[model samples]
Target chain A: MFSIASSELIQIFRNRLVLITSLIIPAAVSAFFVRQHETYADLGSLGYIAAIVLFTVAAFGLYATAVTTLASRRQNLFLKRLRSTAEGDAGILAGLLLPVVVLTVVQVTAILTALAVVAGAPANVALLVVAVLATVAMMIGLALATAGLTNSPEHAQVTTLPVTLGVIAMASWVGITGTENLAWLKRLLPGGAATELTMNAWNGGVAVTDSLLLLAPTLGWVVVAVALATRLFRWEPRR
Target chain B: MSTTPVIEVERLNLTYGDFHAVKDLSFEVRPGELYALLGTNGAGKTSTLEVVEGHRRPTSGTVRVFGHSPDDRRAVRPRMGVMLQESGFSPDLTVRESVGLIGRLTRRTDDVDRVLDVVDLTGRAGRKVSQLSGGEKRRLDFATAVYGTPELLFLDEPTTGLDIQSRDAVWATVDRLRENGATIVLTTHYLEEAQQRADRIGLMHQGTLHREGTVSELTHTLPGVIRFALATPVPPLPLHAVVDADGKVVVESFELQKDLHLLLGWAQDHAVELRDLAAGPTRLDDVFRAINS
Candidate 1:
């Protein structure tokens, strides 16, 4: 698995287009949000900015990149090549996605830390960490499921738009509006519970028990995404 | 050197929706043997190979590699090396990196540099796969397949895009591996390769095993040919012969050597020059052509 991940890391840095889309673009977008934190914080809250930045990195950096990587590998038969080895299917996938997952965690951590430094630390750092981990899991799951529907790296652009945009939009709606009007609906959307959890962690005044309950919905998305991935994900492209 | 088969397939059937890509195919590759599976286009050779390699499951059949299921990668794969029909390396990776990655995944240890040297790709080691030419990419693929010198190797059209020298090098490497008692399963369009190297050959057509045998066994089913052109019309030939459109005399003979001697003696007695005299036993290509018929 480490061998595969190391090779993947090498390829990721070598491809200029992938580097830009997966790393630079998300970092730049997150930097802008961090730089303009004050304005966005006034519109929503500091926690809201945190959630937006997290979703930005997750959607583009982790999610979109993984979908494109998998689709590209499948189209080129690299996945098939890997399977020709002694590695199990699960190990192969873990190896291929490990680098992207680790990178997303690092990026999210760095960006969230910067947000905390400028806009005051969150009320519950532990809860915020949980939110980040859960969000990453959800996004990775969705990416696997989306990769099945994607034919090529070029097709990934069209196939990934809905989920990428939907989650970001969900983060925006739940983050900016505070989830009071349609509380149940807000918590039920894919990214809604995670966004609200991030807000409560950073902006306080919510009960710890209430915030912990938010995990159920987020975990539910994980289950749904994983189930969908199992059915949809393909190791090789269509014959 | 055990007689037990190294690979086994029994009544294998593979279907893609409504299309039956492979029918009830059954063949076994014995230990320390080079078994070549040759077929016409759309003959299901690739599909059968994929099932044996555990890339796809047969709709109904049993495929065992070394007494274990082929899908049992942890058991079968560590001892087997597969050279796919296409170049599947990430184009962004250097040839060396590609070899290293695949080599490690095979769970068989060998010097990466040595494998590159085997394929004469040491000079192109640092070059990314994207920068290599078609032939170079093929050599790179060959390099990886021989990385650990596994017990069993699958070479799928291993010489398709290769140049003459590269092709010779690949066969030479296979020769060395065979010397070490490696079992090889090969599929190629070059019938001559199979004829020269295979201990046994399985010919597939329309998703079925059309024929299976050694070179002599397969070729012997078809008659050998003797061809010669006469400068001047002679008396009735000693053997039955047909004059083609170009005035070339053609004789189909099961007894090639006997018929050739009679024709040579006839020509000598008449002092008639037999131009372009060619006589040989039936070739593998003839067997392949006969499949369609």
Candidate 2:
């Protein structure tokens, strides 16, 4: 499993698209947020903006990446071939997901660092770590769930679009609008937990109540998404 | 004969919704033998192979590889290798990386360089899988399948989309593997490939084993053709089991000598010349078509 994970990491790092999305996108988004912080002169305003940026990366990096990888692996019959080997289902799934998880972690760290340095904002390290972990798990589960509905590699991007768009809209609005009711509703959104967690972290202390609320939805999505993926995931490519 | 069968299937059945992909299939492949699964498209050949490879569990019945159930993949997989119709390497990974990665999965690993050389991909080892031509990619697929030095190998259309030269290269590697005491279960659309490589053939049609035996056994069971062209146009004859066409006559029979003698006497008495006379045995394709139709 470790060897498989290492090889997958190497392959993911070599992919130009994944590299750009993971490294370049977060930096650019952080720059945009820094400019907004200068214009707005409100610390709370930066938290919302950062949450939107983090949400976008979560969707693309974790969810989109997972679905695309699974679909392509199925199309190429990688999943089938893997199953025929000594590796069990868990090993195969973990190996395939390892690279995406690592990329998400790196991207999250880069974005948070940019927010702290460029925006002159202090970060709550412990809360940020929890948010990153939760967001990564949620996105992975969501991607696998989406993979169940995708028939081929071509449909991966399209199948992932609906969830991605929904998360983006809700997470972005909750961050930008700063509405209390929206924050409560964000708890139900796919990336809402990550948004709340990131915001709470930027506030320099863990908001235990808010973090716990986000955890429920985030963990709920994980359970549901993984269950669906395990049930519906086809080993072979569907014609 | 050895008591241990390398692969064994008992009443294996598979279904895709209402479609019966394979039904009541049973066979065994012993070590040092090349077994061919011969079938046309949609004949459940792939499904049968997949069942034995543990990719798909049988809807009914059972499959065992070397005394272990195929469903117990971990116990069986290390001793078996599979070459699927499709290559599964990441487009970004080089040929060397792909082979090396699979090698890590096996309990016994072959030297990547030696395996690549066997497939004649050593020169192109550094090339990305996406950059490889169709045949090169296939060679790479073959290379990876053998990387584990498995005791049993399942080759699903291993030579598909290859040039004649590449096809022969794959054939040679298969021969070497068999010589080294590996059991091979091959599925191919190419009748000639099975005729050349398989020690015995299993003909599958409509999700069932229509026939199973050596090539000679199948041909001997089916009708053989005897065709001859005449030097002069011969009058039509009301001959039994014979086809009289323009200046030629064809007789379908298992007794070649008796049919040839009868044909020669009829031509001579009618003052017709016989030229380009050819008497041959039946071909595998003939038997295949006869059974399938």
Candidate 3:
């Protein structure tokens, strides 16, 4: 798993396209919005801004990267080549996702640290951490599901359109607007619960029961997406 | 060399829904010999190979590698290497990285640099796969397959994109590996490569093993021919001879040596010059051609 992850990190992080999509745009967007503190009347706006930044990383960084990387590997016969090796199928998938997962963790840490320095730390820090971990699992699962639909690396950009827009747009909506009439929308969409949890983390610490309630919807998405991925994932290139 | 075969396939049959891809095929690759599996398109060779490689399950029959089923990949794959028609390397990885990845995955303990050296890719080690030319990529494929000097190696069109020099280098390496007691199972379009290298050959047509033997053993099944043009009007030979429209005499004989000696004596007695006299055993291609018929 480490060998596969190390090789994948070098190949993925080296590409200029991935660098811009996965890191630069997300960081830049987060920094720009984060500097606009006067626009927020409450200090809790810090976590909301941080949520937007992390949203881009999950969508483009982990999810899109996973889909394209897996699809490209399959198209080029690398997956088939690996199948002939001593690595099992589950080990291969874990290795493929490990680098992206690590990268997501690092980038999220950076965002949270910045929010800490600016807003003096979120009140419900434990809940915020759980949301980040849950979102990571969700993104990885969704990526595998999208990869099943992707024909090639080139096809990944288009195939990932629905997930990218849904995750990022809902994140942006929850970060910037009121939830008065859109209450159910927060639990219905894929990343909605996590976005709400992150955005509200600075308000106060939540009860353990409430945290689980907030996590259930996203957790459900992870299960369904992973189940679909296992069934749909192709070891060979699409015909 | 050991007497036991390294790979044994017994009455293997593979079917794809309504299509029968292989029919009761069977062959063995003995230890330390280069065995070539030659066939025409859709001849069941690829299907057979996939089953042996554990990529597909045979509809019936059994394939054993080192006395274990190929489906027990963890037990079998570590001891074997396969170079398919395409290696399917990730273009984003450098040559050295790609070699290392395959080596580690194959449980090879050899240093990555040494494997690259074997394929003459040491100079291009730092270059990404995308930067390498077509022939260079083929060499990379060869490098990965031979990473651990695997006990059993499968080469499917190994030299397809290689140049003459590179082809010679690959064959040289294969010779060295065979000398070290590695068993090689090859599938290629180049008949001469098999003719020169294989200790035994399995020829498949449609969905069955049409013939299997050493090159000479297979070639001897057909009659050899002697062709010559007369300087003047052609005379009948001591043996049964046929003349073509171009006025050239042709003799087909199972006993080519004795018949050719008699024909030489006949020409000498008549003082007739035998122009363009050519006599040799039938080639592997001829045996292959007979498959379609």
Best candidate, DockQ-wise?
Answer: 1
Q: State the lDDT at B144 in candidate 1.
A: 80
TM-score of each: 0.98, 0.89, 0.93
Ranking by lDDT: 1, 3, 2
Name the regions of candidate 2 deviating beyond 4 angstroms. A38-46, A118-124, A152-154, A176-179, A182-184, A204-210, B233-243, B257-274
What clash count goes with each model?
0, 0, 0
DockQ of 2: 0.63
Of candidate 2 chain A, the 10-residue stretch with the lowest lDDT total is A38-47
Question: Residue-wise lDDT of candidate 2 within B56-127, one digit each (tens)?
Answer: 779999788889988786788888888878787778788898888777675556799999999999999999
**What is the C-alpha DockQ of each candidate?**
0.91, 0.63, 0.71
Per-candidate TM-score, first chain only? 0.98, 0.87, 0.92
Position B217, candidate 3: lDDT: 99
- Candidate 3 residue lDDT tens string, B229-266: 86677566688988877769888889999999999999
Q: Give lDDT tens digits, candidate 1, residues A79-188.
A: 99999999999999999999999999999999999888887888999999999999999999999999989999999999999999999999999988887799999899
**Model 1 agreement with the true structure over B178-234: per-residue lDDT tens digits:** 999999999999988999999999999999999999989999999999988876767
lDDT at A236, model 2: 75
Which residues of candidate 1, in runs, are more than 4 Å off? none
